[model samples]
Target: MPTLKLAIADDHELFRKGFISMLSNVPDFEFVLEAANGQELLDKMPGHQPDIVLMDLQMPVMDGMQATEVLFEQYPTIKVIVVSMYDEDRFIIHMLEKGVHGYLLKDTTPDEVEKAIRRVADEGFYYSDFVSRVMHRKMVNRLPANKHPFFPNATNVGLSNREQEVLQLLCDGLSTSEISDKLFISSRTVEGHRLRILEKTGTKNTAAAVAYAYKNHLI
Candidate 1:
């Protein structure tokens, strides 16, 4: 059982200290760094090499969203888990799209915090039941058929109905496994659909595929 190095970035000193205090009692958790804002976290991250970061979305300098993006761009292997007071679906969806490993509300229990960290570290993502339901609903409520006019060549790209479902889920920021569960398909099958969707849409990655879907009203 190797210790997991942890970093926390939050503007509130009291909340940050509370997390540190809680982590201090856990045998397998190591508190490596704390920063008041995103820029400071980025600045301190290079040499510390934490395994996971507990990020706050609202901070004085740069904020968590920008920091998460920059951190992953620079160090893609680092796992980021957002811990904030916000439980809004939109915010959760946005963080998911930006490739965060997990989302936790500030009021989350200590046990949940531990679970979220371990799950994200081991399984790649940790979305609570609420977050999962929101994601599922977002995908289910998409327009029945393509309603908006698409790009000149995009409509001709011809994505199938199943592939369109996968694309909408991707746009909603569901992980491959989450999408699989939602659609009652295997993750591999979901991935295959994703690849085909990209190919048919002539896009490169999930983000691009999502953009193409929105622009073409394929969702």
Candidate 2:
């Protein structure tokens, strides 16, 4: 097997060093870049291009989300498998939707990590086809309750008609106060609906929520 070039972008020195040390025993992985943050990773990508990146979610200068967005937009060829401590469905779905190949927790065994890396490198995915099917089928339309897999919990709490109206106006570039005025509701209520939307869609902010709405054909 061809040795796969690898890179890891994490803030903790111990984790990075330890992970590299662990992988040293495995000849399939060759560490080419060890970045302290997302910016460093991107800055070094021009020279040290790895076949796959093990990205961390939380870092100081330029977070993993921002870097992942840039990677998905710019370095479309490089596979990214998020290796973080967060195993929540929200975080997993968040990274997966942003074009990452996989999401693994920080404490996962080295063998599992290597398996995930190899799967991503060879098959262009770490999970089974079920996940891909779920993503494509559910994200393309507003599914009814109990109609999906990755977001089983989220789909159970489908958006209300009022919430859909709020989302449409938000997509139309209306501010919270403006939406409140147009809908004859308080700004607080509109803000509350926005938060709920974000929570349900596993989005970080209004922009992400709007993107999710467009992806799901909600707006």
Candidate 3:
């Protein structure tokens, strides 16, 4: 298998070294570059062009949010996973809005980190169990009436209840395969539901559909 190229950006030297060491044993991950801060990350990224970036939220010369915005603007294909000490809802929401593929706490184990990287690289979103729970609860509490819970302006015109459930699972960041396993259905069935959901909502992608749902208080 081809290795996944990764770049790590953090202000602290010790933590950067520790992270590099921890990832050294993961077979498919290759550390392609390291940066002391977000500015350095931005400066080095054009040349290195790693597939994934492990970013710290707080760093000198430029913070992770700024760097992430810049990176996404310039390199939309590169995936970013924020590994930070902060777990505030504001920070989480902000990073998500800024297009971070994953948000992880700093205390995550090395194995968890490896898993998260792999998941985000494959599925486009990665959340720990705790983060998942938090997001779910938040979604439940914020669910809006008169809108399909997964699509705000979506009329729910021709969708069945099962399709709505699948959309919710998608908005909750479950991959189609995961949704199939969770619902005890086939992956192809889940994929069909996804296509229908996209059509009904008039959204091109999952992220935009989710954002529309959230913005209009649909979920």
Candidate 4:
């Protein structure tokens, strides 16, 4: 069987050690590297490109968010699974926007952590039951006519279904190629949808277009 190479970035030494110890017992996983913070992760990345990264959200010398941005910019194929203590919707949305493949709360059991690694390594998404519920609630509350606090807008220049699908994936931080693969569309078709989305939403770039979609409940 092929081993899945993994790295971890966290500030707490004990937690990092504990995580490595737990992962060491997993048969299919290989803990290849560890870092204390995002900057260290970046500094060490060129030498070892892991298949999966377990990252803590709050760290010094560049937080997980910053690290995610850099990682996506440089190594788009590396899947990052956030293993943080935060469960807030805002934090989850932000991480999703920054392109994290999975979100597992820090208090999750070792078995669950192992499962998440396997799941994300194979499928590119891992959400515990609680996390899945939270995501569902957020999505339900954000429906255009819901009139909830999280709802962005009710009636706007609504994007087409395909456009909305692309926009949601984009907001979730999937790249053009990834989106194309997920939707089983051509890259050129995905690019065309993105351009039309920007034009319809009056946004300048992918980021702006995503912001507009979220702000307008188009996604």
Q: What TM-score goes with each of the models?
A: 0.70, 0.61, 0.80, 0.69
Candidate with more favorable, higher lDDT: 1 or 4: 1
| lDDT per residue (tens digit) for residues 90-207 in model 3 | 6776676666778889899888998888887776668677666655555666646555454434344555779768867877778878899999999989878877766776654454
Query: Cα lDDT of all candidates, in order?
Result: 0.79, 0.75, 0.78, 0.78
Tell me, by lDDT, which candidate is best: 1
Report the C-alpha displacement of residue 194, candidate 1, in angstroms.
11
lDDT for model 3, on a 0 to 1 scale? 0.78
- Per residue, candidate 4 scores C-alpha lDDT tens digits across 1-219 of 799999999999999999999888878788889999999999999879999999998999899988988888898888899999998978876675565777889899888888888867754566566755565565566544566555444235656788888878876657677889999999889989888877877654464455445545665
lDDT of 2 by residue, 17-99 (tens): 99999987897789999999999999999878999999999999998999989976778788888888885555766666576
- Model 2 is weakest, by summed lDDT over 10 consecutive residues, at 127-136
Clashes of 3: 0
lDDT tens digits by residue: candidate 1, 63-123: 9999988998898878898999998878877777676877889998999899888877764
| Better candidate number, 3 or 4, judged by TM-score | 3
Q: How displaced is residue 3 in candidate 2, in Å? A: 1.6
| Cα deviation of 129, candidate 3, in Å | 1.6
Q: In candidate 3, residue 123 scores what lDDT?
A: 67
RMSD of each: 5.1, 15.0, 3.6, 6.2
